[model samples]
Target: MTAKPPTPVRRFGSIVGTVLTYVAIWLGLVLLIAGVGIRWFWGRITVRDMMISLQNVDLPAGYTREWQGFYGIVVAPLVIVLILAACHAGHALRVRTRRLGAWDQRPRRQRRRTRALSLGLALILVVTGASVFSSSVGLADFVRASRSTMDIGDYYAAPEVTGSENQRNIVNIYLESGEQTLSDTNLFEKDPYAPLEEQTSDWQSIEDYQQYQGGGWTMAGLVSSQCGIPLKGTIAPWYGGGNTAPPDSIRTYLQGTTCLGDVFKQQGYKNVFMGGARAEFASKDTFLQDHGYDEVKDLDLWKNSGESEKDFRPDWGLSDQRLLDHAKDEIDRLHAESEKTGQPFNLSMLTLDTHEPATAYDYCPVDTESRLISVYQCSMEQVAGYVDYMKDKGYLDDTAVVIQGDHLKHMTSSDSFHEQLDRNDHRSIVNRVWVPGQENKRRLRPGIDQLSMYPTLLEAAGLDIRDHSAGLGVSAFTDAIPGGSAQALGPRGYRELVATDSKDFYTRAWDGEEVHG
Candidate 1:
């Protein structure tokens, strides 16, 4: 029997040879492709392309050519190689399993080759795709002006919280996709998101403030509007997020890292930081804390429980209604403190009820058609409802409601929106301020951003500490409120304002610490 076994050792030399050859080919191909893509993408060439990324950041003409070339050659390629290697290793292991082993000898060298091939292919696909996609994202598309036309130093502030008031109560509401059209026919009235006007018709009195176009995304517009973080340089989701450090914001200096919230907190005002979305998303909490918030409210604590995905609502975790459910409780707490100290309160509500990808809330009219309009109206009405709720609680009269959009949605700018609504438009921020009673009646202002809203509220309420300088768009109700033309200062002015703001902030938050804070 032993001698008979020597007669046959499974003669499959041809099969083994063929598989090994193919494995080698794929391995080489994957590596070649991945290496090429990594080098090209990682270069980060700042060669001035007219195309501006969402943050209006582009490889400036004469930027760092060496760095760009480095990415194309070293950094990105290395990352790509690693990613591809992982994928290929998995594939190589899979190919050497019992089934494939019948055809090949499962040689260690051959297995290694096949794994590298699979991994390289995966790396090439990922890096190449990201590079290509980043080139065309909506943020990069809308910016038409070259960097030369914009001045970063004008609006530039160093890394510090910019302050404007001593005890101004600031409330910024970021509407999901609030786009205002020529006829007031918003695009949020459809399947995904509903309009706020439909639910809270009381806002019908003031609809002119919600503007559209210019900068489309939130990081671009909201960042610029709120903190004077221009839509000019370095777009975000930046690789390092400009390092979430205090004294880095574009607000003011007297309080340094201290914003309107810090200003009020110092003035004995309660800083209530509330948001309907993830509280910790995008270091918003860090920014708030540096600016002087004692407690940043997490609107969706329910989502944190050790529960399955099924527990979440169609809108992810909670609806605007659910958040509204607790609005009274939050407000009551604020009121209790206000009563105790006779000190004013600062309420910053960063709402996400109007968030897109899920149009869970009812539109203002209840008859939805355009998704952009519908969702915005729903959120706006929620804004209105919040006011009413406050009115019933007697807090509405004193509270300065700042309602604005986080940024516009990309889906709304696609060809589908053009065909559906017969329009080509970008989502604008819902940057309107609502102040009840006689004080605001004489000067009802228009739209603004989270950054600007903070300072503007402080100003309107007569709460100034350090002088704010880098603001592009003035307070909606600034002393010289634009009474006629709503023509906002162009992108050039905005860029100038943002670029120069942060230095002043740091000058106050840190450099000026001995003099101010």
Candidate 2:
């Protein structure tokens, strides 16, 4: 009798099995690649950052490009090969099994080979799944541990206007990757921020006090500086969403929260945030606009506002020089508008030239082993020049200029000259407050963090901050309350202050929980 052809049902089942096997293999590979990539790129994966990505928040253009580049270079081709190999193997196994007819009829060697192949693939998938699951559980445990512990207590001063309407024009500049390490003589042959040091030395420096807070990057640093709280993300969906909801919608993230911009808005100040980099990254646009910024102009905004085509967009955004130039012009316009409205203005500027990973724009005189040093030096000159311009324009006379590094340089000890230095000893941001035309005053503040700047911002603008504590941070310029200062917390306490998600008093502020003194 002739061998009967396989039924359509059998054929379909075989095909389905093959497809399922291929899909399983592909998924395993993809998961492995993703975990490895995140680990490599981010150094450490935080729930907050993961949530931001899951929420589909638009990352900066440069970052997006880099991510795509990484995928193209690493994942895409590997996935295709894996899928094809898995499919081929499944098809061959299926054909072999079919030819064998019954499992008992098949040769022992053939049966064992088939069983081994099936078991091997299953084992790989099982292992991969277990790994992913364990990692997720680890993150959850970390969050739980953080939330259970506490450091920052009920440290908030309700920010009442003490004396006069201390509404000085505010020029706040955030230098990217600018750190105290740049000035550490042991780290470099020559100080990279020498120019910045000279300019800001007369201004108030918070070098004596340094502590880790909620700032390790640009966006977090900005939030920490403005809110007197670290930008810690909640595991539960923020802004009234369920736990599994995405964090994409940042517009209402701070609905109940108050920031420096909000305070300025309440005080009748025109708040403007100008940064050369894309403001869309890290929900900066949403955060700033929603907080109280009247105008949030970024590189895209500048381009749309009729900038010359001759200006080539670099990998990041506009160069520091160009950004400062544009900032000067924007300040002039805001000053003019403020004059007409008789309202004080807050000009928030973020520089992009000194950003990390690589230096795309270098215009520094310093000769250094690391390119980052050169970048910082270049930034220093531009910052000093801008300050000088403000002085020449007589803008400084009425402006409270607060120049600070958004965060410590995002380089490993091996990545720079700080390889030999203790991590804690070398990690600090550049903090300087200059009340244009006032005799430069040096305050002996020690062990401060990013949160200190929030109250200090108002203080520099001439407001006498009652009790000096605003939100979770205290002002570096004022006398510290007993439990308020980082010195009181100590280094370990300071780290714990921002590390745990449980500091409801501090984290709740992000969700607009009313902070009481």
Predicted model with the maximum lDDT: 2
TM-score of each: 0.54, 0.67
Per-candidate clash tally: 84, 4
lDDT by residue (tens digit), candidate 2, 364-410 = 45466677677778878999889888878888778888888887765
Candidate 1 per-residue C-alpha lDDT over 1-517 given as tens digits, one digit per residue, 9 for 90 to 100:
1111111333354345444544444444444443443334332212122122223333445535434544544455557546655775586578768455443445645655865675466556555544453442322322332323443333332223244333334455665555444123343333222234443334322234432233444444344444443333222222222212222343322233334454466667767666656545544555566566677766356466343444235544455655665666777887777777776776666556545554544333444444544545565556667766766776655666656555544332121254433324332443445565555554544444433443555555545423332233344444453322122455444433333323333344333252221
- Scored by lDDT, model 1 comes in at 0.46
Best by TM-score: 2
